[model samples]
Target: MNTVIVQPTGITPADVLAVSRGGARVEISDAAMEAMRTSRALVDDIERAGRPVYGVSTGFGALANTSIAPERRAELQHALIRSHAAGIGAPMPAEVVRAMILLRVRSLALGRSGVRPDVARALVDLLNAGITPWVPEHGSLGASGDLAPLAHCALVAMGEGWVLGKDGARVGAAEALHAAGLRPIELAAKEGLALINGTDGMLGMLLLALNDLCHLLTMADLTAALAIEAMLGTDRPFQPELHAIRPHPGQGVSAANIHRLLQDSQIMDSHRNDLVHAVQDAYSMRCAPQVAGAARDTVAFATEVAARELVSIVDNPVVLPDGRVESTGNFHGAPLGFACDFLAIAAAEVGAISERRVDRLLDVCRSRDLPPFLTPDAGVNSGLMIAQYTAAGIVAENRRLASPASVDSLPTSGMQEDHVSMGWAAARKLRTVLDNLTSLLAVELLASVRGLQLRAPLTPSPAGRVAVSMVEPFAGAPGPDVFLAPVLEKTRGLVAGPDLRAAVEAEVGPLR
Candidate 1:
């Protein structure tokens, strides 16, 4: 993997994933280095002025009114890091920690936060060295920008906390730093506040979720398309003319994708003019684009929010270009919190609708003339019966997880930091919902492909045939349910990626 260069310009979602999940190195640009130096001078000037500043000279949170002696200023930074590293629950994944560190590093490099260049450089080095910090799961209330999680992340870099070993055991931070041929740097002046006060954790999760959803949503479209043909339903609702009147960008795109995928289909032609099939399909088959499209638009909106956050200066008492240090509300995570919540609900809706199609495929009454549960021996095999149940189970779980975390809040930091964002929880729950949705879509794919195969001489669409090929080896022949868990798991592995979409797109041109 290539190194991700950090500079005054900006970073992208791709750069974040590269460093976080791909183990890529980071390099700070000279311009960013110069900017950091210039900002640090401004902080030095403030300290020499002997005036009280929020983070540089005084205490934090409810203690903001207290004045700190110059000698104790360094202790303030250390204390802030140590005290705030009070996160609980299981440790965060190494990738999540890497993303938090990278985003924090990017913020410091922008020259707004008054921190030494070495502070940012040290973080980049740690990222490159792959020495991930042991951040806990349940620390952030999402206010003050993931303070607890970021604190734990920064702690390992300061040689005072814990690191996750290769085998995921907790190791001494100092020992890890030494092993990596790196030394931990002490936080100076307002550096501690700058390091921990960011929306990096929630924003990082949102970005990763967005990338994953992009592929998964496309997969959703394909799976929905397969289900429509597998159940011998008409594709008229997917026609471009029908969607153009609505004018929603996502809806139009999804409609066109299904319309194109259903082209040159022998199965659709088999029922094209038959009075035998219902004039219209059920809501799940007819309105997949409507639900999935709304979800796509939601993702678009969240991406806009994440993009703006990428360039935001989210530190307290930031160094202004006009030479003044001022506290700010930019660190509030409401924007990111709202975006995460929106995506979570969208994931739930998509999964719920996909589960409907999965159930339809297994229902002998609704699945056209297909056998009950797609089984050769109905009552004897109970074939794929619980598979629909699994999809239903996930859809129900997602409904619970879809409840917005950002909507809830509690007072903290002596009530000075009240009205928290809870964005971290929102983002965390979004991840789980998306995971469940990936499985839900996989179940749909498994059932639909089996439904199409059960049709025998009645061929499917060209794209649907390609989709069957993608899952056939893993799906096996539509038969008795012989240990179905591995099959669903294998199909989910494909459903969670771009391979299925790519394969179909290769033959059918492209899906939206």
Candidate 2:
């Protein structure tokens, strides 16, 4: 019911997240509308004065030099939309389509794309009415601004594509718009190009991934702390002063968060002066701050990159207010693509370490007296041995999926779109990695919770206790011969819940 107005300079990840989560509405400012109007007027003047514009007066891609007659320009725009709607593969989920709509509207709202105000309004109306266009998951080379996928989005505005309605009904875009009392947007001059040419689709995936990764990173911290407590590992590895000397922002933040999570913990200090003679734990347990911190740093960088792109007008052949049209390459997705790959690598490592921790929890020798698979009847039940296998499978899958997509490219549009970034592939793979990592964390959480329960009356660190209490309601205490899949799924829901992160933060305070 609340609306958040985003000015050109005031967009934040929190604002975007709020909008994406359906808690807030997005509205553009009057200055932004004025800019769009000025740009549109320039486009009209150019078309009337018979000037040669790359996308306005000519065909797109390899046919950029071919001129369109004045009378058929509108037809040209319409044809562009209809012909380019060639998206393939499974349809993108509704949340992603909603994010794409929000991001694209924000970009055009910056007013440099030469799109008509009505076109921008149509996109906003669709968002307000919950009309999500059926955008497919494939068919983008990632060089020309996610062309095919975005065209599918533009088709809905023209009343030709499919839309998912409020009550979960599938209907034609025209009927959906008519039902909502909205009219189809008309393309004027550069409006078609503006609508279809941008990094919004790829960026939408990245934004959603970033939101999930933020939660995952915090979950990783909590899981790592639980694993450390289970292993009775020394807390010296996360000492704040030790991290301050090296001074990597992410490492320091990670160390502080882990230390906070383990602070005032009778369990963590229980093994501090014990006769336990182990020199040090494995890298997965001892170097958790370093590994998790690196991922956190990458996420920080990727967040900045995505935020910078949110307000950028990325369409080509931009129309200036002085009636000048200049051809450019703002449609390239390389920047966001590189960030997406980086995020995948980072998130993949989180899964890798989590799988290792799951292994540690399963091994009786490493789990500090916890029963094998934390089950009393391990021989008959086989306990959580298979859960570790599932975690390892997902971790290996993440490694394959995290292979940098930006490194591969293929020519399209007869070499006019040569040297593509494959950004959509990178974004898609990042989402996959996020899912895989979430599952991995869920397994780790289930194992850690089981291990913590074995240490029952030995109260965990204050932070770990809070985390355990949060998931305990959903997962319950693991018993012998129980089906682990339901428990794992419930653990995942807890990890994905908004309150989990808030609970962890409340217990541990700001993560430095």
Candidate 3:
């Protein structure tokens, strides 16, 4: 009988992830309920007063000034859902759809959207009952607030669109609603526009990508720690005083995390014998914290922007308590659009440095006495030679995707809706960058574990040993190089899962 309630003020990136992962039940607050009531009352008063209102008593887009007859109001609302539900692309992954539903619910529960309480309750009911609508992944220009993608979702409330059932099969939305003992919510004043016009599509993707990036940054820190140990690099660059002077939050956090991970490593100490034989290590080994820290800082900035966007209502022709229907640009996606692009660049940088470590690990001359390509018989067995090639390719692709999506804008809706934000493109690229970084870090993990094996009997630090143990079970030592593709895939899975991340954090403190 334990329930976790999320108020507008209390929701975080972690909370979004928990709800998307089906880890908790969600409810709107009583205060939120009252706010929704007040808002809806104002909308009714406006309609009763016989005033012009956008999207309520009138048509949408280029037809915004065109008024509808009183008798056809219901028809107008229904047509909004049908015509705007023109999303044309592959189906969005179930997780992203769930996130969109949850985000839309949270925004409405803030009580500024003028939607009826029944509409809010229906969204919350869908989240609790796990009836996610089948939303297409594309067709949003990110202005007019992701209309197409969200309309496809809003169709479910009208007892239309596809629904994913508990058994993993698609069914009619009406059937799912009936099975859950619910009915199609009647569209009240401004309800249709409130349901479909918001930045939920881009916001949902950003929420998911941000949550993953937070964890991936921690994983990157751990991977960099292992790479540092393997390369026998100096830790003085991460000294607290050095980072304190400049004091970028992410840099300080990364430096501190790396220092703690390498705290007890004897191998990290200045070695006279190794120093005489070797000069300085490569930039990948030496500047791990600085590069990784910048990416972490960018993510922190984006998280702040996204968190604010989530709680605030982004609907248009918003109803005020004073009975004024004010049309504003709050629905613009520029803020979220820019934040997602910035995060994409940040995540791509993490992949860039991790790929360098993979390269260094493969080069026999650079690797300081490890066998060529980490294969004892370099000529016969290719070992991890091709693995670096894969990592390099991924990193190169990440660079291309890192270009800012917000910088590009196009006119839409016959020049009436000019200057689109392209927020969806930014969110999409951020997700891609995250996937590439995961594979890149996995390659680094594999190479570091192999490097440690080659330098065996020379024990790694406690934290490194824990990281190695988490991945080692999934990937055993490569002997004579049979197919390594599976090993690499397993390593990627190990690093990406929450369990292995938890294990690493247990050994080394939180990599915040």
Candidate 4:
């Protein structure tokens, strides 16, 4: 794989994915190296002047007023990293830690952290050598820049903490570094602060979550189309002109997707002129565009926030070109906190609406002509009945997780770090919400595909046919349930993976 170059500009979420999950290499640009050199010179000048800088000379947090001698300043930076690397609980995923390293390197490359080029290069080398730091998941306040987690991440580079080896065992950082043929660097003035004082940890998780949701939301549109066709619902409500009256970009896009997905459908054509059929479908079926569209808009807003964060230099006591360092509140994570909470709400709502559709599909009275629980033999075979319950349970959990973590704050660092942003909590729970939604959508898809099969001689839309064929191998032919957990697990993989979406897109083009 080609190396994902890091610089002051043009860092996309795809780059994060590439470095974190794609097994790609990374390199810092020459422009960034020169900038780091200039900034590092400025920091050295400030040290020579002997005036106390917030992070460069003075103590941190509650001890900011204390001054330190030039000889002790380097020791201060090392102590800061050691003290702050107080994270607890299990280590974060290697991919998350890698993205944190990548984003932190990119932030330092912006030339505002006043660290040496070798400091940035060491981070890159660690990433290339696959020496993932054992960063704990629990110790971030999401303010003052995910201090604890980033400190733990920085600990690996200082050769003081543990790291995950290639065989997945936790080993000493010194051993890991030696095995990779790289030696750890001792702390220099402001280098340790620059390494750990960043919002990169929380931001990395949020960016990856945002990217994953983009694909999942598209899969949602495709799955919803399958359910609508399975239920013998009309697609007239998805007309572009009808959606145009509302003027919501997400709504119009979702409506257009359903419109394309339902084209050339014998199933829909069979019911077009029937007067006895209900004129309008339920809100879950008829108003899918509105629900999923609103969720799409939410994701778009979060993406915009992540984009700004990608380019931003988030640090305290940022270095200036005029040979001065200033302590600033840029390290606060409120923006990412709100964005993560907002996306969680949207994901929960999407799952809620999807579960309702699943309920309607399983309920005998509401299913139009399909049998109860989508079983061919009624009570004798309770096919997929419990699946609806599972969806409901997961959706309920999402609702609880959707409660905004940003709104709740607790003072930290002896109240010197007061008014912290709980962005890490929001990001962590959002991951759970997104994961739960994948399973819920898979259940809905499985149920919908079964419902379509029962429609019999009436062939579905081209896109619906493609979706059914993609899911059938895991879900198996429509019949009484036999060992449903394995099938549902496979179907969940089908829903979460790119295969089902690729099949649908091959037939009906890409969904919104």
TM-score leader: 1
**What C-alpha RMSD separates each model from the true structure?**
1.1, 1.9, 2.1, 1.3
Best of the candidates, lDDT: 1
- Candidate 2 lDDT tens digits, 1-512: 37867565536666666776764776878877887788787787787789888888899999998999988888888899898888876778887777777777777777677877788888878888877888878878788788888888889999998877556556799998898898998887777888888888898889889888887887888888888787777777788899988877888877877777777777776777775733577899878889888988998899889878876668787766666788778879999999999999999998899899889888988888888987877887788899898988898899999899999998888888889989999999999999989899888877887787778788987767876787777666756677778888888887778677677677767653
Candidate 1 lowest-lDDT run of ten: 473-482
Record all residue pairs in model 1 with backbone atoms less than 3 Å apart, i.e. clashing: none
Misplaced by over 4 Å in model 1 are: none
Candidate 3: TM-score? 0.95
- lDDT for each residue of candidate 1 in 12-130, tens digit (9 for 90 to 100): 88999999889888999999999999999999999999888999999999999999999999889989999999998888888888999999998998899999999999898889888
Report how far residue 195 has shifted in candidate 3, in Å: 0.3
Model 2 Cα RMSD, Å?
A: 1.9
Greater-lDDT candidate between 1 and 3:
1
Q: Write the per-residue lDDT of candidate 3 for residues 348-437, one digit (tens) a residue.
A: 888899988878877887777778888788898988899999998998899999999888889987788888898987887888889999
Better of 1 and 2 by lDDT: 1
